[model samples]
Target chain A: MKPSDIFPTIRPWVEGLVDVWPAYIIKPQFASWQVLHILSLVVLGGVSILINLRLIGVGVTNESPSEVQRNLRPWMHVGVIGIIVSGVLIGMANAERLYDSVAFTVKMLALVAGVILTYGASLPTARADGRVSAGVRVWFLVGLAVFGLALFVFAGGELVNPGVWHMILAAALIVLIAAQGAAPVDLSGGPAGAGRGPVRGHPFHRQAGRLRAARPGKHRLCLGVPGVDLRPGGLAAVHRARSGERQAGQGHRLRHHPRLGRGRRRRAMDRLRLTHEEGPRGVGPSTTPGRGVRSVGRPGRGR
Target chain B: MLRDFLVWLQTELGKGPGEYPMSWSEALLGSLNFWGLLEGTHLLALMLFAGTIFVVDLRLLGVTFRRTPVSVLSQKVLPLTVFGFAIVIITGLALFYAKPLVYYHNIWFRAKLVFIAIALLNILLFHGRVQRNIAAWDTLAKPPTAARISAVASLSAWIIVITLGRFIAYDWYECGKPIPAWANVLQECAASEHGAASLAEVAQ
Candidate 1:
């Protein structure tokens, strides 16, 4: 069924509610709903990224993926409930207008699909394996596709006028394309395969050390521990080494690192864009201090 | 004397970016096709930057993701966060260049900048004072009160900043046009002689 079609059944009821309590949404105090909506988004997006990062084993290495998920799960529920309440209030305030708005309809569909994928699929898999299952990855891409479609329609709402069926067709096409595109990429391994069963030798650690050892002059450390100065060159060198190791180890390491999903390499490129100024820098641990851990931030000679 | 200096600065800057050769570039970017693309990237970057920061702050609050040491999480997520922030900076500047004077006179725009400054200051205070001894609570499931307070402050600052940034579009405060008297104190644009220039001339 078309998105517009599904909403119509309840649109009359919602419109009636709006008519009775016009000031509920129109009054100045209703602005808080907007604030709450945005704040809910902060929580939702925050926890979503946290869990996703955990899945990739990038953040919270000390905690198992399950522990991370369990800790954040309650907050995610609160965020979801807040979003629902705020979202309902917003829709009720301008029911008729929103009912007719293509952007609104698309946003609702995306939010539903996103919720399902997030709570139903992605989180569950992350809870189990500390990594997103391949199936969840596909749905995740579809959810992103729908979300992007909503954004597109919302941004260009005035420019394009499409019927409900047309929007649904477009959304379907987007999901189909995104699923096809994401199918080939292996997201199961996590970022640089960091989440794969922990091998005795931390591959990234060794690569980081080797790269640091190879190019020691460009870096100046405040302490004797590794810090987050992983220049593009260093990461590129590490990327190459990781690729070779993946081939040799075969299935032990991920072929592609889900740095932050698709377009990660572009994001990486942005980080590396400043490489010309800080050439041949050694990749190291972040600068935040942790007692008893070897930080290795002290200045050392370059190879 | 201070008022004069401020007026002169506003008048000069409020002359709009169109006065410079960069205006041509701005015109190109402001085109319907390009503007949409820039906006899309800007939004995406915002999500990444905001999302990453939110997770980091949550860790500081000891709210969740406690298994990982704070230092390690900071190191791992920061590069990507910086990358997202870099995109936002680039796109934000381009957008500003498109309508410098208009944005300059906007109260919401000014508020956004203020919020950003406050957020940065909060970051500084946290890193300079509290973070120096982060190692002690690096693995604590519930960080100390100071860290939690810092986290709360950071989150609040960013929320206000984001809200203000969004409002910049809705509340356009154009130079060469009348604005609220209160806004005049902040912008001094409405009364400036330079404010008399039409938006077209500003685009020129």
Candidate 2:
């Protein structure tokens, strides 16, 4: 069914509501709605950008995708609610004009596609906590392809007027490619290692330490131990030694080093108590804090 | 004195097909679909820029990313914010170049400029003063009072800037219209006699 046929049927209901409400009667009402719409879009688009960037292993590389999603979920909810309420009001005010606008039709379709891509595909795969499976990755590409196909069919396969769609498609393609390209290298503990890639003898050992420190609960434990150096270089040395032990089949020896040893580390951690007033010292401005003591006892697992 | 210079600058820039034959600003404004695309880019870049700033400001206010240290969030997110800011500035300049006189005479645009100035000053205050002691409160859910105040100032400034920016598209307080005396002074409508005469002609 063509959108032309569908829009006509819905036109009357919209027009009737517009007549009753007459949002345009007030001089500033429609403009206020526009401001609200754009503001909501800022929130929505910003959250989406950050999440997508994280998925591609670009920005906020320290936090796992799942954690980033958790942190941003409330803002996402706010953006969604604000956009919908303001969008509906704007639509009601301009029903007649929007009824015949091909751009508006394409926008609604694209909005639906975006929501699906984000929630159905991106969110689910991200929630996998960097272990995105081959199947899920394929599905993500498929979802992106569907959006492109929708644009082609609806917008007449031309680049005319809908330059925004072209930009969106190009950006999505770049993000997907980057994510896919980084996946294998990441598995081998490369600089882009976002997953649980082993860091044994990696050249980017310092970066690896910073990345690990970015994870929740790890940095706090590192900081809580008073004497142990919490600098990235210091952490990297510990990581390198532990990884070397693992590589040389000396996993058992990890228990001997005071820093890596589980029993001593825990005792050290227990001895130095942290009050909110006395924050961790000597930690650099860029070093992230841990979420809590959740990962204190269980150390050397992911790193 | 500034108003006089601005008016002179606008007059020089607005020279076009008749008198100057082919002016840069005139060419930009006359290009088909270029203005629309420029406006679209300006808005998109604004969203990206403002959105990233919003995230950072929220963090500073201790409203979000409480578990994460302020430094880490800033380190990771500020780069994206800078990227967005670059695009916003570039496109914003292009938008202004397209019609310098109109925007110069616009009350809302003037108000937007004031807020932008405030936002920039707040940013300076942040990086210069508030950030020096960030390590002390890096992991705290809430930052120091100065940092929080900076965040509030930044938020209010940007919000007002954006609202005023949106209002610029409306003709309610545009020049050549019956605006209040104070608004006329603020917009400096009298500074550009040539612009006012041209607008009067257009109005007729």
RMSD of each: 14.3, 12.4
Q: Can you tell me which runs of candidate 2 are displaced by over 4 Å? A: A1-6, A9-11, A22-27, A133-146, A153-303, B1-20, B192-204
Best by DockQ: 2
lDDT string, candidate 2, B59-85, tens digits = 889998888888888888887888778
Candidate 1, residues A1-303: lDDT per residue as tens digits? 223455557756766767566436453445557767767776776677666655533444445567667877887887789888888877677677766666566567668777877876668876785445777777777877776766665545563333333446546543332221121121235457763221112224344455557877522221122122233344223533332223334332223555455465556445343332233222333333431211112111111
Question: For each candidate, what's the DockQ?
Answer: 0.21, 0.36
Q: Give candidate 1's TM-score.
A: 0.59
Candidate 1 Cα outliers beyond 4 Å, as residue runs? A1-17, A22-32, A56-62, A130-303, B1-30, B172-180, B191-204
True contacts kept of each: 0.39, 0.45
Chain B, per-candidate TM-score: 0.79, 0.85
